[model samples]
Target: MGRIIAIANQKGGVGKTTTAINLSACLAEAGKKVLTIDLDPQGNTTSGLGIDKDELENTVYELMLDECSIKESMKKTDIENLTIIPANVNLAGAEIELLDVKEKEYVLKNSVDYIQDDFDFIIIDCPPSLNMLTINSMTTANTILVPIQCEYYALEGLSQLMHTIHLVQERLNPNLEMEGVVFTMYDARTNLSTQVVENVKNNLDTTIYQTIIPRNIRLAEAPSHGLPITLYDSKSAGAESYRDLAREVINRKDV
Candidate 1:
């Protein structure tokens, strides 16, 4: 069965979507079949993989409403082993539409039921806020991975996000686990970044990946060009860090 991992953080601009796009791409580059679901209505993951969100015929929104089969929504990305179930602004209304559905929280989980074994890994990019969409993702995910930015307010809102995860584990998905934390936007020149890392280590009782993603211009530029760092500039530091992170992610799971 494919391991379902949700890349989530209520805090924005922390490289949540960036990690989702690149990590999935790197995993595919490692010869693993990967399916990435864009749960965020913004659909950055979809576009990051070179899919035009506006032209999509089917999206996660349709899957949530039972308007289309999971296979029907899965679109091939430019990356060889990477597939995506794109989303759009239409998905913003899915929560309200799903209100009438029975056990709506499992909508995504149930949708993935038939396709669970089709890939080695299923990556989900969740919205920046905790809402029905996020709840649906957590219910489906085996683990939640948080991307914390190396900044002054790095620790802020994390407790609440953890609390929400705890509640989800308690009430909805007992088997759900924290996939631990990955630090993003690290600037080696700044002591503040290192301090934030140390502070988070001291405060949060979770596994912290040793692979730190640095603040790279190429990383920021790739998304705008609709290419992952790996494809846009494989030689860049951003691409190297994500590749390292991907190896770490897979090796950790192996152990």
Candidate 2:
């Protein structure tokens, strides 16, 4: 079965989508069959992989609603060994639509179970909120990977997110686990960034990857161009760092 890793953080603007795109791409480049699932209604991950979300005939919205099968919703991306199930603005209403559904938390988990054997990994880009969508993602995932930006207030909402994870483990999925936390947009020249990293390491008691993603212009630019850092600027520091993170993820026994 494929390992489902949900790239999540209730706090927005923390490199969640960026990590989702590059990490999935680099893992595919390393010869693993990967599937990227866009659960965020913004469709950033869909467009980031160079797929136009609006133009899609089927999306994650339809799959979650049982309007279509998983195979019908899957879209092949530009990267080899990588495929994606895109999401668009229509998914914004999923929270309300799923409110009264029976077994609501397991909706996504049950959908993904049928396709688990077809890929090596499934990376879900969760919405940046502790809403039903995020709950569904956590309930479905085997592991959760959090990306913390190296800035002030980086740990602000982490306590709530961790608490939510604890609830999911106790009430929903007993097998759910945390993959690890990785720092992003790190500026080595700033003392604040250094402090944030040290504080997180000391307090979290979790695995923090050694590779820190620098605030690279290329990393920011790639999304607008609808390409991952690896395909847009493979020589850039951002690309190299994500590649290293991929190796770290692959080697980790818990992952």
The lDDT of model 1 is 0.95
Please state the error at residue 97 of candidate 1 in Å: 0.9
Candidate 2: C-alpha RMSD after superposition: 0.7
TM-score of model 1 relative to the true fold?
0.99
Q: Which candidate is the best by lDDT?
A: 1
Residue-level lDDT of model 2, residues 28-88, one tens digit each, is 9999999999999999999999999989999999988889999999999989999999999
Worst 10 residues of 2 by lDDT: 246-255
Q: How far out, in Å, is residue 70 in model 2?
A: 0.6
